[model samples]
Target: MSTGFKCRNCGSNEIEEDNARGDRVCMNCGSVLEDSLIVSEVQFEEMGHGASAIGQFVSAESSGGATNYGYGKFQVGSGTESREVTIKKAKKDITLLCQQLQLTQHYADTALNFFKMALHRHLTRGRKSTHIYAACVYMTCRTEGTSHLLIDISDVQQICSYELGRTYLKLSHALCINIPSVDAFDYLICLLASQYLLERI
Candidate 1:
């Protein structure tokens, strides 16, 4: 009799049965499996789909798997698998900038949070993370009223301004929204408002 087993490595269920029948190896994932191990059909399918989704997310970044999310508690990977690799990469970048530029931790946190929020919004509407990250950084610098030029930010992020500009154009084209012109004066008004609100408290 032939029995089925799920691959622990790749979450693939179409494991082939060996002639010995004592043990099995997953053809898709190359994981060793035993007939005694039982996994629910739903769990196997979910883990498989999750792995595929994460793989897509990681490949979205231009840099090779520099964006690997640690495995999670799901059927195969570790707990961190639920989070996207791009999100973690953004956080690390923000932290590095804060350390190098001597910016306050609060500013770093705010920048990271804004990037996360913007990326999530655009992605849910069918945009890519890499495009969003580049845009988010530009928007962040503008919104924060930093004297640092766009070229400087691009250099620091190791993203070419030309590539980022092209991505911005594509994102704007896809979203059908104009990239609003950033005004340094407008940012000052925002900062003043924030200070006033703090004083009132």
Candidate 2:
């Protein structure tokens, strides 16, 4: 934009505002009268995907250069995952394991609580998440008296029975949970007579 205002430096009547370059300049004298004049106007357009934001979000605290403020690649630990990601993955694995075992939502929620307790206590460090999650589910079953077998969880996820037992024991001790011993007849019923078999019979 050409202005009738004269250049303060050269005293020439050739002042121009360059919106594209974001500067007010003396065209003839090649002197910058003002700088850091960022254009704030934005036009919104509708697209099939969504409403498109044509301009970048500028921070109000930024003094110059139109600095944008937002999160980029949230990372923690190994830089590939954040706390939310770990928790989400744990929940997904627990849910999938619960589904495989045909357990209820209440059981799944109980297992998730166990997992969170383990996490808070730092019992999850240097250990496999799936193992801890499976242990949590097993503990849930034991506490709720749901008659689920640790072997069933191990079978569905291809985990070792010993590892699940170890994790179960570790979680129980650390969390101070006192689950009573399951009956031998309960094991026999679960092993010899499956839910499907009982339904069929």
Candidate 3:
């Protein structure tokens, strides 16, 4: 048997499963209905595949280059000597994408670098970047006390927290390990705050 719910938005009779909330959004409106549902691993994988495809689509359209290109290779400074190729995914370009979206390159770069380093730490330890990035960004704003919302991140990355969360789980399973720091986000916020204070004073 199946169950149905009412949308808090338009009171629609039909709702689409909202993977993030573990239920679904209204077919007519886009209101979250269920907020306590857990997704299956299979569905998680499929979402990942879909997100990757979308990322690739965006990449192909953007002048930044094509997606699924297996990360852009570049040298880190000085005269064009030996180059080091860093392999990252289209999702890794969140920083650039966000900046492009907001038209704020400087601050966007700072945020991006922060996310990249923080994400690298988490992912290296066997966590998922997508999830960490989403959570970290949210918590980072909270810590820094900024007013950025998960929706903002969603717009920039073209992925939602629910989807990102699932991706994180799948990536975690594949990596085979668990992250131990729940305070990294707060720590980063404090660190950034202190830096700002120093710059001001």
lDDT of each: 0.49, 0.69, 0.42
Clashes of 3: 3
Clashing residue pairs for model 3: 17-24, 18-24, 20-162
Task: Compose the digit string of candidate 2's lDDT tens values, residues 115-197.
Answer: 76576568899889888988888888887788677787888889877666666766777877657776784444334434434
Predicted structure with the largest TM-score when compared to the true one:
2
Q: Return the clash pairs for model 2, or none.
A: none
Comparing 1 with 3 on lDDT, the higher-scoring candidate is: 1
Query: Candidate 1, residues 48-103: lDDT per residue as tens digits?
Result: 44523322222344342324344554332233333345557877776676565565
Error of 1 at 61 (Å): 35
- Tens digits of lDDT, candidate 3, 1-201: 113766675565665553322445443322345645654343212464352221121233654322234434532112211111122342345455545445344444334434433433344345445555554344334334455544566566766545543433333344332333335543454355445546756
User: Could you give the candidate ranking by lDDT, starting with the highest?
Assistant: 2, 1, 3
Candidate 1 clash pair list = 71-77, 71-78, 72-77, 72-78, 72-79, 73-78, 73-79
Candidate 2 achieves a global lDDT of 0.69
Model 2: runs farther than 4 Å from truth? 1-81, 185-201
Candidate 3 vs. true structure, TM-score: 0.30
What TM-score, computed on C-alpha atoms, does each candidate reach? Answer: 0.40, 0.53, 0.30
